[model samples]
Target: MDAFYASVEQRDNPDLRGKPIAVGGLGGRGVIAAASYEARKFGVRSAMPSRVALRKCPTLLFVKPTFEKYKAVSNEINAIFHRYTSIVEPLSLDEAFLDVTYSKYEMQSATLIAQEIKNDIRNELSLIASAGVSYNKFLAKIASDQDKPDGLFVIPPEEGPTFIKQLPIEDFFGVGKVTAEKMKANNIFVGEDLLAYSKIELQQMFGKTGSFLYGIARGIDHRKVKATRIRKSVGAEQTFSENINDEISINEKFTQVFEKWWERYENHKLKGRTVTLKIRNFEFETITRSITETEYITNKSDVRQKLTDLMRESIVAGVPIRLIGVSISGFEIEETDTEVQQLTFW
Candidate 1:
């Protein structure tokens, strides 16, 4: 899936095709959820402020996000993956990792499997996808981004070390902006630079994360592609136009959030024993309070009572509340017909 939300909008609308379009909220504090490739050329990107995106591309078309449609497309792709392999690990609504080690088709070529998957997505879903074929997840993820829009890239086991050595430190898995800066300060700017240090030295410098970086630098990732991901929680939150301090307005917002949470919970057919209340104050302080009950919480009264108690403890007369969220966790999920059991080799 390429530029997922924006692409969906473009695919369904004739006028938006091959045009600069952004999909997200269109408010004063709105942010770009996704930007089309056409919009990217104008410096628009996801998570960028809408105002900033407009400044960069004045003619950019702003469309509200349609998550239901995205999820439907995601489910369609998941079904397609299950046709080839059961070992699928979804990274998000748009991307996933499929372990075709023991594919149902018994295909020996991972490259061919990737090609078929990309082709199916294009032909069936009216969408384009870029795929990366590699022996391990770390390398596969890096390879996927090597080419953009509609591309397929592969890294063979024998060529992985050499390929990784040439990559910059920022391109490494789990190396974010802050970590990249720290690596640059320590003169670790590329895989070759990172590999030059001893494992013990890296561990001493970066603690537990140093071990992870060291293994990936050497092109060693032992992680398996897990098939079934248990969703432990479902929650919803709302940001107010203005900070709220009164009890009536607070409860009203909680009721709205509860409706959303319940909708999601029922959709997943899940029940939980724990309820968590999250509060963000006008001063930007965030707080969470959770309680685990003997019986699974299933009704509005149970959730509202717990949330109200937590709010009472956090809300002050003068302090205004900026955000409120309610969540249910510590739940068990039963397997459904749609989910395929993951197969592991080793």
Candidate 2:
């Protein structure tokens, strides 16, 4: 998928097609969720600062996101995937990884499967997609972006090395700007340069990420494509409207967050025990705190109490907090019947 949300918006609304559009915030401190291909020409990109995106593409259309509509479209596309294979792992509302190794469609070629899927998306939904075909997940992911806005790219196993060799270090997966700059400083700019180093040498220099980099350089990825991914955890975190580090201010913010969670999800009858707390310092050192409760809890207040206690103990007064989050996991729901509810009330 490419510019998934923006593409969906453009598909439903004729006016936005071929125009630069952004799907998320257009205000201060907002980050780009998706950028249209037209917007990308002006240097607008997803996860970029919204202010900077405007600076890049001043006339870009800003559409308040319609997640429900997008979700509906997502389900339709997912049905097409299911027709081919049951092993589909959705990465987001837009993107998914499907293993067609044993598909029902009898499609032997990954490239062809990609082509048919792209066609279905365009003809039925009036949207475009970019596809990558490769033997493994990492390589497949890298392949998917080779073309954009209704394009298909393939990376055959034999040609994988040569393709990766010329790619910039910055363009490689998991190499962020800071890491790219570090690699540049070390005079490692391309896959070939990355491949030149022994695994031991790379490990000593880059530490934990060294082995990962080495594997990508040689196209030696061994990661599995898991379709039945369990919901190990469910959590939400926010970078504040304005970043706040003061413990008291963050606690207040936590209360605010808790209040919202309580109002909305509490009534839905969700159950989870192991509550986890996450905090990010001003500099982005993340810390997590977790507590298990005895109850089959659903109310947000109980979750909030666990949250506040965790925050109170962990937060230091002077530090500026950049982000905070709460998560629940490790349980199953006991569905309530109407009779049970009436009995409890009585």
Candidate 3:
């Protein structure tokens, strides 16, 4: 699924076809959930401020998100995946990983299976999906995203090393802006550069993450694709219109945000043992404090009290705050038991 939400809007409403559009809020403080490829040409992207996106592409049209519709389509696509292999690991509503290593079709070729899936999506759902076929998840994931819209790329075992070597360190999964900068500072700019360091040396620089990086740099990823993809956490955050320093005002905003978070948690029927309070100051420095209860959070009042206590202990009354967030984790949401087979799709 490419430009999922926006594409759905385009598919449903012919007027939006070929036009630059976005999905999410159109309000001043709203953020984009997805953007059409046409909008992407103008540098608009998902997670961007809707205002900033409008500034980038003045003709951009913002449509409200239709989660129900998206989920329906997701279910349809998941069913299609099940036709080939039950080892489908859904990453989100639009994408998943499948292990076709022992597919029911016994196509015996991941590349062919990928093409068939893409064709089925386009023919049946009137949508495009890109795929990557490779021996391991890491290489497969990178390959899937390498091409656009309706691509199907393959990374055979023989070519993995050369391909991985040329990839920029920043492009490796899990390397954020800060880590990328650190890698560059240490002359580890690409996969080959990363390969220069011994495992011990890389570990010294990146701690536990270094070991994972070393394996990927060598074109080795052994992680299995689990059919049941359990969500570990869910939360929400807000960036204030202006820096807040007053205690009463901060708590007021916290209460408002917590209400929104609680509504979502209940909607998902998720409970967790830990509640985390995240705070960022005017200078952009951020910190988090968390409290884990012996029992899972059972009520809004309990979470609110924990949030109140965490904020009180963390915040200096007059310290201007740029952002505040609340989150809960350490609970595994139950997953429907789908069967197992593996093939890769982006």
Candidate 4:
């Protein structure tokens, strides 16, 4: 999926094809959720402020995001992936990692499977996808982004170390701007530069992340592709059209937001021990407060009481509140027995 949300909009509307478009809110405080390749050419990007994006690309077209449609498309893409391998780890709505080591179709080469998946997506969905096939997740993820708009790239095991050594430090996964700047300050500009430092030195400088950096620099990522991921937290929030200062108004709005979130929580049948309250003031200062119970808060009354207590402790009197949210977390993992068969190479 390339420019997923924006591409979906373009696919559904012919007028938007080949035109610079963005998917997001068209408001003062709105942000760009996704930018089309045409928009990207003008330096527009996802998470950019709508105002800034418009300023950069005056001809940019803004379309409201349709998440339901995107999810439906994602489902279709996932179905295609399962046809190739059972070990599929979804990174997001638009991207996933498929371990085709023992593909259901009996394919031995992951590159061939990748090509077939790309072809299936294009032939069936009328959309373009970029794929990266490599021996591990880190290299594969990096390779995937090397090409854009229906591109494919592969890094065999023999080439992995050399390829990583040449990559810029900033291009490495998990190296954000802050971390990149820190690495640059220490004269670590490329993956090869990282090899100069001992594991102890990196760990001292970056804590747990340092250990990860040390391994990836040498193309040694031992992480497995998990077929399932745990749902960490479920929460909802609302940004008000206008700021509310009075306690009565705040409480009313909070209740409304809480009820809506609770309905969603109930639908999922999720149980959690922690209740969190999130508040954003008129000045955009955000604060969160959480309370963890000894046992799971399964019923509405128990959860509501916890949220109410958090609001009382967190909210500031007379301060205008622009947003309110509630969430539950600290879920207890349920164990179940399931088995997946895979071919063992002799």
Candidate 5:
């Protein structure tokens, strides 16, 4: 799935084919969630301000995102994957990693399986998908995005190093803008440049990240394909358009945020102990005051009251708060059978 939201629109509507489309809100505060290939040519990109995107391409066709429809298609595509293998790990609604090492079809090679999956997506969903065939998860994920929509890329173990050395550092997974900037300052601009530094030197320069980068540079990733990835943290943070200081105003804001979080936790049936209040003053200094509840949060009103109390105790009326966040920690949401069986035994 490429340009997922916009692609779904194009797939369902024949008239939208090959047309520039922007999905999400089209107003001033709106941001692009997905941009079709045609939209990309016009400088429209995901997470970019709608105002800027429109200025770049005056004729950019704006389409509101229909996540439900996109999710339905995603489910269909995932069903297609399960036909071949059950070890499928979805990164998002549109992207996934499939472990076809032991597949249902008894295929001789992973590349063939990838090709067949791509073809099936196009024929059944009337859309395009790119497939990556590699020996491991890291290489497979990288290879998947190497080619564009309707493409297949395979990285054989024999040519792994040459392939990795030539790959742009920016294209390497987990090497974001921050890492790239540091690498640039150190004159390690690409995979080949990264390969020049010793593992010890890299570790000294980048701490834990150094070793990870070195392994990727050498195409020596040993990470297995993780099928059941769990959440590490679930929190919401927001920066307001302007600072607010009135006690009434801050309480209102905190209440709204707490309500949203409570709903999210309820929908997912998530459990957590820590309740953190993150605040930023008008001068731009940020601070967090968190408390771990003795018992799990089971009510929305309880969280709202606790968060408001922390906000009041932490900041004064004179201090204008620019941002506020309510965060929860120690989420052990998975209701495992072992735990359930223990209860039964008791």
Candidate 6:
């Protein structure tokens, strides 16, 4: 799915096709949820401020997000994935990893399976999808982004190590801005640079994440693709167009966020013990307070009281707030029987 939200908008509306477009709120505090490739050419990107994106692409069209429609399309895409393999791990609404070592269609080559999946999506849904086929998740994930729109790339086992050696440190999956700066400071600017340090040395420099960096630098990813992934937390946040300092206004805003969170919690049928309250002030300072109960919080009043207490403790009086969020975690895991199959080598 290329520029998923924007693509969907374009597919549904002819006027938006081939035009720079963004999907999100078109307000002062709004962020771009997704940007079309046309908009990307002008340096617009998702998570960019709406105003900033507008400046980057003055002709950028803003459309309000239709999440319900996106979710429905995501379900359709997942259904297509199921036709090939049951071992599908969804990263988000737009992307997933499929382990096709023993696919339902009895495909021996993962590349062929990827092409078939891409074709299925395009032919059936009238949308473009890119795919990466590799022996492991890390290389596969990296390869997936190498092409644009309707494209497929394959990284064979023999090419993985050499390919990784020349790759930039910033391009690694887990290397974020802060981590990349630390790596650059240590002269670890590329995968080949990482090879100069031993695992112990890397660990000393990067803490726990160093071990992961060491493995990926050598194209040694041993992670399995799990079909079922347990969600750790469910949360929602709202950014305000105007800052509110008064208690009445703050309470009203908090209630709105709380209601949205409650709706999601009920929809997921989640039972969790911890409730967290998050607040961001006008100065951009953020704070969070949480409460954990001995048992699962089963009622709205109980969660609301916990959030109210957290808000009372965390918020500064007369300080304008710009955002509010609520979340619940520490969910009880229900045991379910799932059959694990041995990988079949071709």
| Candidate with maximal TM-score | 3
Steric clash pairs (candidate 1): none
Assess every candidate by TM-score: 0.75, 0.74, 0.84, 0.80, 0.79, 0.83
lDDT of 2 at 221: 77
Model 5 CA deviation exceeding 4 Å by range: 237-251, 266-346
For candidate 1, write residues 104-192 as lDDT tens digits: 99999999999999999999999999999999998998999999889899999999989989999899866778788998999988898
Candidate 1 local distance difference test against the native:
0.84
Ranking by TM-score: 3, 6, 4, 5, 1, 2
Error of 1 at 253 (Å): 6.2
Per-candidate local distance difference test: 0.84, 0.76, 0.84, 0.85, 0.79, 0.87
Worst 10 residues of 5 by lDDT: 337-346
For candidate 2, the 10 contiguous residues with the lowest summed lDDT are 337-346
- Judge candidate 4 against the unseen true structure and give its global Cα lDDT, from 0 to 1: 0.85
How much is the lDDT of residue 321 in candidate 5? 87
* Two-way TM-score contest, 2 vs 6, winner: 6
Better of 3 and 4 by TM-score: 3
Best by lDDT: 6
lDDT for 163 (candidate 5): 84
Per-residue CA lDDT of candidate 6, range 1-346, in tens? 8999999999999999999999994788888999999999999999888888988888999999999999999999999999999999988889988999999999889999999999999889888999988988989988999998777988999999999999999998767788899999999888999999999999999986788778888999888898987776778888999999898998999999999988888877868888788899977787988888888888899679878988988888888899999988777763242212212110
Higher-lDDT candidate among 1 and 2? 1
Candidate 3, residues 1-346, lDDT tens digits: the string is 7888898899889999999999985677677889999999999999787788999999999898889999999999999999999899887788888999888899989999999999998999899899988999888888988898889899999999899999998787657888899999999888999878989998999887788888889888887888876666667788887789987889888887788777767776767787788898876678899988888888788679878888888888788997888777766442342222222111
Candidate 2 per-residue lDDT, tens place, 1-346, comes to 6788998888878999989999996578677888888999999988777888998888988988888988898899888888888889876677777788887889789889989988888788777778888887767877777776677888889988888899888777667787889999899988899977989999998886788778888887776666754444455667777778665677777876665544544544556677778888765578999887777666655566667888878888777787777766654642221110100000
Candidate 4, clashing residue pairs? none
Q: After the best TM-score superposition of candidate 5, give how far the Cα of residue 92 lies from its true spot, in angstroms.
A: 0.4
**What's model 3's lDDT at 145?**
85
